[model samples]
Target: MSFFSIFISTANAAGSPLKQFEIYSIAPMHFGNVNVSFTNSSFWMLLVVLVSTLVLSLGVRRSSLVPNRLQSISELLYEFIANMVRDNASQDGKPYFPFIFTLFIFILFSNVLGLIPYSFTVTSHIIVTFALAMVVFIGVTIIGLVKHRIKFFTLFVPKGIPLALAPLLIIIELISYLVRPITLSVRLFANMMAGHTLLKVFGGFVVALGFLGIGPLVVTVALYGLELIVACLQAYVFAVLTCLYLNDALHLHH
Candidate 1:
C-alpha cells in the first residue's frame, strides 16, 4: 500500500503522523476531468506570499534617517541576500539580486509559516520542491548557453584531466549535473517531511499517554525549535546553491 494509504487505514485506530500532510480542497473545482481545486496547500502558499510581501513592504514603508525596528529588519534581510549573492556569485551577480531575494524570501516564508500549527508545509512535498529546483536548474542552464554558446559543454569537462580519463569524468559530471534537481528537491522535501513526521508522532504519544505525556511533550517542543532552524537553514542553503550554480554559469568555473 502507498504511504498515505497506510496512514488512512490506521487513521481510525490512531491519528496517523502523515495525516497533517494531507491536502484538502477548500473550494473543489473541476474542468472536465482535471481537478483544479483550491486546496489547503494553495491557501498556505498564498498566505506565505502575502505575508512576505506585507512584511517587506511595511518594513521599509517608513524608512528614515533613524531606522525603526521594521526598517532595520527589512534592511537586514536585504543585506543578507545581497551579501550572499555577491559573496557566492560575485559582483556580476548584483543584477540578479531581486530574483535571488524573491526566491529566498518565498522559501523562507513557506518553511517558517508551515511550522505554525494547522498550516500546510508546502516544501514537505517533493513535487513543490522539485518544481522550484527545476526552475533554478533550467535558468542556470539557459544563462550558461546564452553566455558561452558551444563552450557551455565545457562545464562537464573539468580543468585538469588526462585525455584517457577525461571522457569518463565528463560522463560522471554530466550525470551529476542532470540529477541536480532531484538532489536539491529531495533534500528539502525529506528534511521537512521527516521533521514534521517525528513531531506528529511525538504529539500523538503525548495525547495517548495522558499523565505520562510530559516526556513526549518536551520532545515535541524541542523538535519544533529544531524544525524552525531547519526551515531557515534550508532556505539559505537553497539560495546559496543557486548562487553557486549561477557563478558556474557566468564564470564557466570547474
Candidate 2:
C-alpha cells in the first residue's frame, strides 16, 4: 500500500469511531399499533433519574443523630439548595423548594454522569434543555397569573415609570420576557454541546497521534477537569435562574 493510501485508510478509521456519538432511535417493543421508540438522550435521562434516586435513597436510608459519611453528604446537598432558594427567592421561596431541589438534582446528576466515558449527555441537546426551560416558563407564568390575577400584566409594566415612557418600557419588558426560554435553553445546550464536542475532538487527536499523542492527551485531561467544573456550574446556574424566575412570579418585582 502507498503512504497516501495508508493515510487515507487511517483517517477513515478515525472518523468512523465518532459515529458512536450519532443519535439514533431505539425500538424497545411495539405496544399494539403504537411503536415505543427511545432515543439515546432519553436513555441517559432515565439513567440519571435512577442513579440519583438510588444515591439519595441510600444516603438517607439510615438517619442517625451524629450522621454517617453518606448522610452528611446528602444533608450538605440539601442545605446547599435550601440556602440558594432562601437567598435568591426570599422567605416565600420555601414553597417552591421541592421543585428547585428536584431541578438541581436532576441537572447535576445528568451532567456529572455525562462526564463518564461512553456516557451520553442529554443536556447537550436543545430538545431536552428546551423542554426543561418550557416547563419552568409555563410554571412561572401560571404562578404569576394565579398570584397576581390581572395584575400579572404589571410584570411587563414597570412601576414609578412616567406615563410617556410606559409604552416603550412595556415593549422592552415584553420582549425580554418572551426571550427567557430561548436564552435559558440555548445557554445550557450550547455550553454542554460545545464542551463535549471539543473534548471529543481533542481526544480523537490524542489517539490518532500515537507516540506523539502526549500533548493532546494532557490537554484532553485538563479539558476534562474543566468540563467537570462546567457541569456543576451549569447545573447551579440553571437552578439559580429558575429560582429567580419563581421569585419574579411570586413577587412581580418589575
Candidate 3:
C-alpha cells in the first residue's frame, strides 16, 4: 500500500487528533531482549533523507551557465545557508557548511511533509528532536574541548566578574549550557506538535459543522499556510541557533 493510503487508514481508525502522531511498528524485529522494530516514524525519516538527497543531487548534477528550476533552487539554498553560516558562525564555520545545510534541510523536509494529511511528523516527537539536539550539543562541546582544552571551561566563567559574583555566575552559565539540548529540542517539538494538533481540531470541526463549516474551513486553510511558514521558520531558527552555539565554541568571547 502507498504510505499516504496506509497513514490515512491508520489515522481514520483512531478518534483522537493526536493519534495521528502515534508510532506503530510496521515490521517487528527482536534480538534477545531488544525490540528494534521498523516504525512509521522511521519510514518518514528515511523518506526525508531520500527525498533530500535525491532533490539536491538532481538539482546540482547538470550544472549550467544558466540554471534550470532544480539548479536554481539548489543554488539559492546553498547561497542562503552559506551566508547564514558565515554571518552567524564566522569564517571558521565555513568548514561545517555541509552539516548545517543538511540539518536545516532534514528538519525542513520533515516539517513540511507532516503537513500532508495523515503523514507522521517526525520532528514533533521529542525523542527525534532531542536526539538531533544532543548531537549538536555534544559535537560543539567536543570541538571546544579539542581546540581550547581546559580553557573551554572558561565558557562557563565570564571575564571581569566580581569575585563574589563569579561563583554564582559560573553556576548559572553552566546550567544554561547544559540545558541547550532540552531547550532546542523542545522548541521544535512543541511548535510542530501544537500546530498540527490545532490544525486537526479545526479540520474536525469543519467536517462536523457541514455548511456551517465555512468559517472553520477558512480558518483551517489559513492555519495550513501559517503552519507551512512556521515549518520553514522553525527549521531556520534551529539552524541559526546551531551556528550561534558553534560560534561560541570556535571564538569563545574573543
Candidate 4:
C-alpha cells in the first residue's frame, strides 16, 4: 500500500478517524513592509471576545439584594479574580488589577470557545500564545525598569549570596528571566493543541466504527468533559502566573 493508504489503515486499526485539520488563510494584509495573513483562528478569537463581552455585560447589568442567577454568577467571577489578585499581588500591584482580570477572562473565553465543534483553536498556535506571553514579559520588564530605574538590575542579584558566587547567581537569574516567555507560551499552546488533537482522533474513531465504536465514543465523551475542566484550569494557571510575575516586578523578590 502507498504511504497514505497505510496511514489510513493504521488510523482505522487504532480506531481513529481519518479527518485532518487544515490551516486556511482568510485574508492577506500588509503593515508597512510586513505581510500578515489572517486565518480562521483569528475569526474565532474575535468571536470569543464578542461572546465574552456580551455574557459578562449582561450578567452584571442589574444589582439586587439577592442577585438573580446572572448577577450572582457575575459577582462570583468578579470576587474570584479580586481574591486572586489580593492573594498573589502586593498593594503596589493593585493598579494592575484590570489588566490581570481581563487577561484571565479572555483566556478562559478563548479556551472554552475552541471546544465548540467546527471552531478554530487559536491558543493551539505557538505564535498566538507567544504573542500574549511576550506582552506580559515586556510589560513586566518595563514596569520593573520604570519602578526601580537603574536598580532594576538588582532583580538579577540574589540576596545573601557570597561575593564569589554573585556572578554565577546573576547568570542563572538572567537565564531564568529570559526563559519565562518561552515556558509560558509553550505550556498553554502544547496543552491546548494536544488535548484538542486527541479529542479529534477519538471522535473520528466513533464515526468510523459504526455500532462497534460505542466504547471509544463513551471515552471521548468523558475526555471532552475533562478537557473543559482543563481549559478552565489552564486559563486560571496562566492568569495566576501572570499575577506572580507582576508581583516579582513590583517587589523585586528573588
Q: Identify the leading candidate in terms of TM-score.
A: 1
lDDT of 3 by residue, 152-196 (tens): 999998989999999999999999999999999999999999999
Best-first order by TM-score: 1, 3, 2, 4
**lDDT, residue 129, model 2:** 88
Best model per lDDT: 3
Candidates in order: C-alpha RMSD to true structure: 4.0, 3.4, 6.1, 3.3
- In model 2, residue pairs whose N, Cα or C atoms come closer than 3 Å (at least 3 residues apart or on different chains), thus clashing, are none
Q: For model 1, what is the error of residue 222's alpha carbon versus the real structure, in angstroms, after optimal superposition?
A: 1.0
lDDT tens digits, residue span 151-205, model 4 = 9899999999999999999999999999999999999988888888888877767
Q: What is the full ranking by lDDT, best candidate first?
A: 3, 1, 2, 4
lDDT minimum window of 10 residues, candidate 4? 14-23
Query: Each model's TM-score?
Result: 0.93, 0.90, 0.92, 0.89
- Please identify which of the two predictions, 1 or 3, would achieve the higher lDDT against the true structure: 3
Model 1 segments more than 4 A misplaced: 1-14, 30-34
| Shift in Å, residue 154, candidate 1 | 0.9
Q: List the residue pairs that clash in candidate 1.
A: none
* lDDT of each residue in 14-120, candidate 1, tens digit only: 57788989999999999999999999999999999999989999988978989899888889999999999999999998888899999899889989998988788
Span of ten consecutive residues with least summed lDDT in model 1: 4-13
